[model samples]
Target chain A: MIRILLPAHLRTLARIDGELLLAIEGEATQGSLLSAIEGRYPQLLGTIRDQITLQRRPFLRFFACERDLSHEASDTPLPGPVVAGEEPFIILGAIAGG
Target chain B: MSKVRVLVGTRKGAFILNSDGKRQQWDVSGPHFGGWEIYHMKGSPVDPNRIYASQSSGWFGQLIQRSDDGGKTWEPVGNKFAYAGVPGTHQWYDGTPHPWEFKRVWHLEPSLHDPDTVYAGVEDAAIFRTTDGGKAWEEMPGLRGHGSGPHWQPGAGGMCLHTILLDPSDPQRIFIAISAAGAFRTDDGGATWKPINRGLHSQYIPDPNAEVGHCVHHIAMNPARPGVLFMQKHWDVMRSDNAGDSWQEVSGNLPTDFGFAIDIHSHEPDTVYVVPIKSDSEHYPLEGKLRVFRSRTGGNEWEPLTKGLPQQNCYVNVLRDAMAVDSLDDCGVYFGTTGGQVYASADGGDSWNAIVHDLPAVLSVEVQTLP
Candidate 1:
């Protein structure tokens, strides 16, 4: 089981309260988790990643176990704490104050 | 009681302002979809309860929100706006071959008689229509496929199809305006189109009278007189009496003809209004005084209407889609400024009042006259 934490706007869009628990087939990777989440909630199709280019939006960042994982490859395995559901993988919108 | 609902889209969010026919007091609703750019929001003419909004952001891409209860509660509709077929290419900034891409929707023009049907004008200069109340969108590629695709260039705002006007008398006819692409008309109802810029002369282009590079800012039409059209081009104020077949300059006796928005009085077809900026490069009012010019004689002569607007050290700009009209017994003219002010003129641009003084920088303003 993998627990994912979406940003506030996405949480309102998907209408989910807390962390989302998903069942992954193999290793808990970012690509597989995103695909699973998009399958579960189709409304979030291109909000996190580009629909055609499949690139992460510049203003979004990914983190897990208090470590920045946005620079890592999508197929890389997530930390053990995230895979074990002890900690939540977070997708945050980078903040730049006006 | 005749009520007025003004749907305002801003850089930060969307706001709904409700008022009675008197237009004295207003009940402001929100900054719904907060922290996102609300490009445009419009209500259905057939069904006043239905409203559609173009919401987007750098982080979340694009989203279309539909409100069935007239700006009360909104639900995200289908945001997938895929261009039909190969989608070809147009001239980029450097005159290079640039492929068409869907960045965001700039306008939402609901059908005049059908709430389920609406047209979306998007950046990259394409028009998409949805018959299922924005649940899905299909591109009407005839506009871009009108044989002038490769020559169309982007303006300072990127090539955006920002205006859509449906002829009320002739349901088969429609008009669309794009930045740096002039104006186009479709007589066969979205199957085929042709450029209708005959007398438009822009000094910026190499050929001052080119057919498809005028950079038309906004166009307006009166339902009673569909043959007569008013346009605010990049530099001059123009008019087309023969339904956009040919245009003539009517920018007589104004402080400066360079402006963004244009509209006609709801009751009078000859009564037109435009906000005059100082120049194309300096996008502020002349001499730090904001005024709206009204042309009662259909074009040659003009008069400044400035009753309650700021007249001292004010330098805000009115965008292309930021002005709109409400068709009540007394015609109401409304416009929003880039400095975050929405002003309303109840007595047909004779006097003005700020409905909301400070919001975000407003992108578009639309009003629904409800019975």
Candidate 2:
């Protein structure tokens, strides 16, 4: 089981109260996790990333295990704690704009 | 008895105001899609119950919300707006080639005959159509494929295709206006287009009468007379007789012609309304008085309709897509301001009342006359 924490607006969009728990089939990478998340809640398809380019929106970031993982390769393995489901992968909106 | 549903899109969320034919009292139901920028919300003329909203945010990007039950409930549809083909470049503000990007949708114009078909005018200046209601969108590349598209540039409000005017008489002919790119017309459905901007003299641009590159603020045409079109350009009030073939300035006696938000009356084809702002730099009512100017003589002669509007220290700007009219017996004129007030004149700009006092800085206003 992988735990993911979405931003407030995305959480509201997905209608999820707390963290999302998804069981990964293969390696627990950002690409695999996001594919699963979008598969479950299709409404959040283009919210966190561009639909055509599949690039993370400039205003959004990814973090887990007290490290900034947004720049990491999408297929790169997540932190051990995040993969172990002990620490949740956090999808955060950047602290900018009014 | 017939009622009117006013769909107001604001900087934050969407609001729906309902009132009977009287248009006196109102029941406001909103902040729907709260905390998101509702750029435009419009109901289909063919199916009033079907409403499409362009809900977006700088953080979450763009979303299309569809309401089948007349703004009562909404469901998120498609948000992907991919540009066709290579999606080449247009002139940026500094006259540099900027790659065309897909931004948020600025306006949604539903089909006149089919509820499932709709057109979207989006930022970065392009048009897209969705045939399956709002589930999917495909770009009509001809508008951007025009030879002069490489020279088109953005206005101060970004390069946005803000106006989509469907020709009621000829279904194949459609008119769309972009911020600094001027107006374009397509005679063959959405396949091809031509820039219909002659006699438009913009002092800001290099050649005052250039073919393309005019910042048209807004354009309005009565469906009854599709041939005659009225435009509120960045600096002048213009009228076109031969369906955008040529334009002539009709800004006769107005204080300042720089303003946004123009609409024509429902019954009377010659009757038009425009809220004149001070200037493009100072986007507020002149002399701190909010007055709606009506041109009954089609454009030259104008009268100020200022009965119920604020005449004292008011500074609110009416955006390009924030004015609409209901086809009721009395022809209600509605507009929303940057100060978050939605004003409605039940009797065709005779008197006005604020249907909603405080919203989140309205971006667009659209009305649907319900039976």
Candidate 3:
């Protein structure tokens, strides 16, 4: 099972409380995990990433295993802890507003 | 009891203000969709319970929220707005060709007769229609595909189609206004369009009387007289009597003509309202006083409505889509300001009061008269 942590607004949108767990059929890369997430919650198709370009929105960041994975490639494999569901892949709205 | 529900969209969230027909003593609901930018919210004229809201953010892109039971509950609808065909480029600010991209929905005009059908005017300049209550949207490309699209440019507000007017007399006719693209009319639904800016003069543009490049801030038409239209341009107040075939300047008497919002009284077709800003560069009212100018003659002669409003030291702007009217016998006028104030004039424009003093910089105001 791969665990993911969504931002507050997205969690409200998906109507989920606490962490979300999903079983991955293929390699647990950022791209595949996002695709699976969107597939499950079709309402979140374009919230975290672009629907066509699949690029992460400028104001969103990704983190896993105490490391920032936002700058990493979408196809790159997630940390082992995140893949094993020991740690959550966090999707965060970037901190900029005062 | 017949009641009035005021739907307000602000910079931070959406608010629902309810009151009886007396127009006094109100009950305020929400900051629903809190922390998100609610660009515009409007209820269908056919079904007052059905409401559509445009919610967007820099991080989450765009979202459409619909409420079937007035403003009590809401659910997210389709957010995707794809342009038709090749999605060609328009003129960028720097004179370069910019590819068309969907940014956000600036306005939503529900069908006059069909509750399920709604029209959306979006930024980056496009019109989208949804037949299944915003579940899906398809572009009416003829407005942009009529061969003059390459010359359309953004007017500081980023190429937004902010106004959409449906002709009540002729269901087949529709009018849409874009910033810096003037106004367009489609006689055959959305299949064909023509520029209706015949006499608009904009000194800022290369050609002062160009047919296609004037920044039309807002356009209002009386349902009883669908052929007559009133427009508040970037620097002039105008009127068209022959269904936009030709326009004549109506910026007469009192104050500057620069403003954003314009609306007509529901009960009186000749009575129109406009908020004059200081100038094209300064968007606020003159001398720190916020006043709504009313022209009972429909054009030229005007009077300022100032009772129950801020008379001094005010520097707020009323956006193009931020004003609306409720069709009560007394005729209530409502508008929201950039300083987070929603003002309501219960007895036409004579007496005014702020329904809410503090919100998140209101972007739009819509009213529904309940039976």
Candidate 4:
């Protein structure tokens, strides 16, 4: 089991509208973890990652174990803590300015 | 870091808009240099204490203003920063001398490498630079149009430069994109300019390759990787790998690549952000929906962020200078629309809040982390 935290904006989209928990059936990886999360929250499928390429959206950032994981490859395994269900996978929409 | 105030230049005048952390309230001030049409305003990123303003009149020529004490008060910086020639140096219209008395310094950019140097793209259809902190300036001769006889008119946005991005790593290299004219690059500090629009298609000519006049509205470069850039062209979005030396059309998956500005993630050189809209029409999002598109791995992929956003008809056009990102660990993306709404995403983009509604047309929104 893995916990997933959505930005305030995504919370409104999932209709789950709150903290979400996802159960997976594979080795921990951005792709597999995302698949399980999206499988449960179907409406969020194309919003987070491209449905076709499974790529994170342009303005979105991913974090794991308190680190920026958005730019890391999708195939990268979720941190061991997340795999062990001790930590949650965090997906944030990146905000930018000068 | 201190409270970063947003400098907005508009038709009314220059305005200093301040925001409380979450954008709960925005304090708008000025018409600072009233009576002049202020086109470009900037607060130096390296030195928040200094600010620059660009203004022009169809009859009075061009002027720039500086504020040392923020925007609480402003003073005209004088001919030192103004672009002008004696009365009859160039052809005149409407009985006034000087080439079409400067309409606007369409774009003003501060060099990332040397904050002392300031660049302004103006209406005389030329680019001007100031080295001694706007205390006197010189023109980059190459920015002048080679084939542009007095007869060739400035296109949609005027013979103006709307965007200029400086390379932080290499001070000598720079990219300048002018509307109606092709893009150009100078690797040796404007000593010479080389046309860098090889792959950028021009809509003016029948044979795309042969066209010379391509309109580029705005262009952005990653501070991390100077050469990696994106441009919102007339009909498409082009990514340039060798600075502006060459470009590749990457709007394959976009609902529409027609946009005013292109911004990249502050930390990630490959990530890009854009507000897409159909080209021919008044540039509204496809399906009447307002969405900000993202390409995480350098245009290789794109996805929309509609979470916590309006699901109904969205008729707001966001100017390139208006959208911004907080980039906090969880990063915050905020952008204001012509509809007078400011929307923010606290979780890098996962969720959003309509922080402020029904404000004046928000010309720009820049956030600064205060110590």
Candidate 5:
């Protein structure tokens, strides 16, 4: 199980004000995490991915165990700490401009 | 030689990047503002020694600080503009103050026309002008004259005024971009504003003018041709030939074709630059790749100029105000990536070199002629 903490906006969209829970069935990577999250919360499909490319949106950031999961592959294995459920993965909406 | 310094603002602090124009010759200093995020900043153009920075922490409210004596020390700027008054102003606050949505100032431009005049685009979706420089700011009521229905405001980021293009030749003819509200101009010294968003693709719909969908992230204009403007809209790149009254798409041929910051050559009207991000997915271009393109012929076509950039998959998010053009004839084009690397092209984007690297996530980059 990969516990995911969402930022304020995503939390509202997912209708979950707190950390979300998702079963990690296959490989753990940015792509997998997003697909899983969107699969669970269908409304958030186009919100994160472009529907066509499945690429993360601009100003959107991903983190797992304090690591920026934005640049990492979706297939990258979950950190041992995350695999252990010590610290949950986090998806953040990066604040830009002034 | 005068030292080259770049200010890199981040959540940790406002950092300083010092370089000697060489490889990895970079020195990053300071969590300058302590823990508060310094998003928008400007080293005083009139007095290069003084620096002005605006900070906000969601609920902590907004505050602008000024540093005299070359950033060695700093102090709060205005009393009315602060949650707590500093010295002259009487306003005070007992707890953290949350800034009004779209209330934080994003960019500060000291008036080249009047040394005492300064203008700032705040998050509250208004443009504030300060006659006494960074002292007190009043919302330019003229902006409200532009039509904005409920559908005109963007979903998020607020349909606020973020770009302020002050005509150096005729200060009265000012151009500003208010995200989803569209591009506007005040030819009579900001007394009235008119929409200039024609031909700009509205991002929310198939139509180009989608009431509140065409977000103009930033706009730049040629100082010589005050009427011409280049704007980076939420959907595409455009140019206004008639002083921002109407626009035409100019992003002819560029990879992915999505980005925030677009810069025009300081001296050349036809030559300009844009940093293209991946449009299919906005996650910092494709595979965290970085590329800054050059359009030597006014965006009719473009060529990728990434000879000396990074080779690894890296997200290079360059803010709207982060890319710059130095005034040298060969025209040095410089930009700082969100990955904290500053790349400079001494020969106009033909070949590049990393002037500095590893600075706290850079927010903005501005270069000036040092005496």
Candidate 6:
């Protein structure tokens, strides 16, 4: 089980209250986790990343286990605590003011 | 009893204001899609219940939302807006070749006949149409494929195709205006287009009479007289009688011609309205007094309508897409300002009242008259 936490706007868009728990089939990588998340909630297909380029949006970051994984390769395995459901992988919006 | 629903898109969210035929009382329902910039929301002319909204964010990119129940419920649809082929380059601010990029949708114009079809005017200057409501969008690349596209440059605002006017008399004829690319018309549907700026003179460009570098703010035409088009250009109010083949300046007896929003009266096609701002550098109303100028003679002669509008200490601006008209018997005129006030005139432009006092600096206003 992989626990993931979305930003406030994404949570409102996906209509989920708290953290999302997903069952990963293979290695818990960013690519596989995003694919699974988008497959489950199709409305979030292009919110966190670009649909055509498949690049993460510049104003969004991925973090887990008190470290920034935004620059990590999509195929790289997530932190052990995130994959084991001990700590939730977090997708946060930049702190830029509106 | 007839009803009027005003769809207002703001920097923060979308707001829907409902009122009866009298237009005395109102009901506000919103901050829908809260915390996101709702650039434009418009209802289909054929089916008033069907609405399309452009929702975007700096952090999340762009998303299109549709409502079958008149905005009561909304569902996110397809947001993939890829260019047709190799998206070519356009002139950048420094006159350098810049790759075209999709930023966000600036306007949405629903089809006049088909509820499922809508046209989206996006930045980087292109038009996309969705036939399955808001589910899928395909670029109509003919507009951007014109010969002079490479020289097109962005206006003070990004290079945005912010105006899309559909001709009701002839289904095959469509008119679209970009920020600094001027306006173009398509005679054979969306397959081909030609620049329609013949008599436009802009001092900002090297050649004052260039065909494709005029910055048109907004264009309006009453469906009754589709051939007669009125334009609020970057510095002049113009009129084109031969369907934009040639234009002549109609900015007569007006204070300053620099403005943004422009619209025609619902019942009176000859009556035009415009809000004159200070200048391009100073966007506020002149002398801190907000007033709406009306020209009943189509142009040349004008009068300032200020029955209820602020005459002093008002420094708000009306955007290009922030004005609209309701086609009731009396003809209601409405416009939203940068100060977050939506002022409406139930009986044309004679009187005004703020339907919504504060709403996150409105970006666009659209009204639908319900039977």
Which runs of model 4 end up more than 4 angstroms from their true locations?
Answer: A1-98, B19-36, B56-61, B79-101, B113-115, B145-153, B354-356, B359-371
Go through the candidates in order and give each one's C-alpha lDDT. 0.92, 0.93, 0.92, 0.67, 0.67, 0.94
- Model 1 CA RMSD to the hidden true structure, in angstroms: 1.7
Q: Between prediction 1 and prediction 2, which has the larger DockQ?
A: 2
What is the lDDT for B85 in model 2? 90
Q: What is model 3's interface RMSD?
A: 1.1
- Which order, best to worst by DockQ? 6, 2, 3, 1, 5, 4
lDDT of 4: 0.67
Off by over 4 Å in 1: A25-27, A65-68, A71-79, A95-98
Q: What is the interface RMSD of each candidate, in Å?
A: 1.5, 0.5, 1.1, 22.2, 15.2, 0.6
- Candidate structures ordered by TM-score, highest first: 2, 6, 3, 1, 5, 4
Q: How far is B147's C-alpha from truth in model 2 (Å)?
A: 1.6
Q: Quote the TM-score that chain A achieves in each candidate.
A: 0.94, 0.96, 0.96, 0.87, 0.87, 0.96
- Please give, for residues A7-60, the per-residue lDDT of candidate 4 as tens digits: 764565355665687777867788998888777765455557665445576767
CA deviation > 4 Å runs, candidate 3: none
Clashes of 4: 20
Better of 1 and 6 by lDDT: 6
**Residue A27 of candidate 1: its Cα lDDT?**
78
Per-residue lDDT of model 1, residues B243-318, tens digit only? 9999999999988889999999999999999999998889999999999999998987999998999999999999
**Mind giving the per-residue lDDT tens digits that candidate 3 earns over B4-66?**
999999989999999999989889999999988998999999899999999998888999999
Candidate 1 residue-wise lDDT at A10:
88
Worst 10 residues of 2 chain B by lDDT: B143-152
In model 5, the runs with Cα more than 4 Å from the true position are: A1-98, B1-3, B18-28, B79-102, B149-151, B203-207, B210-213
Q: Give the per-residue lDDT digits (tens) of candidate 2, residues A33-94.
A: 99999999999989988999888999999999889999988899888899899999999989
Tell me the TM-score of each prediction against the true structure: 0.96, 0.99, 0.98, 0.68, 0.70, 0.99
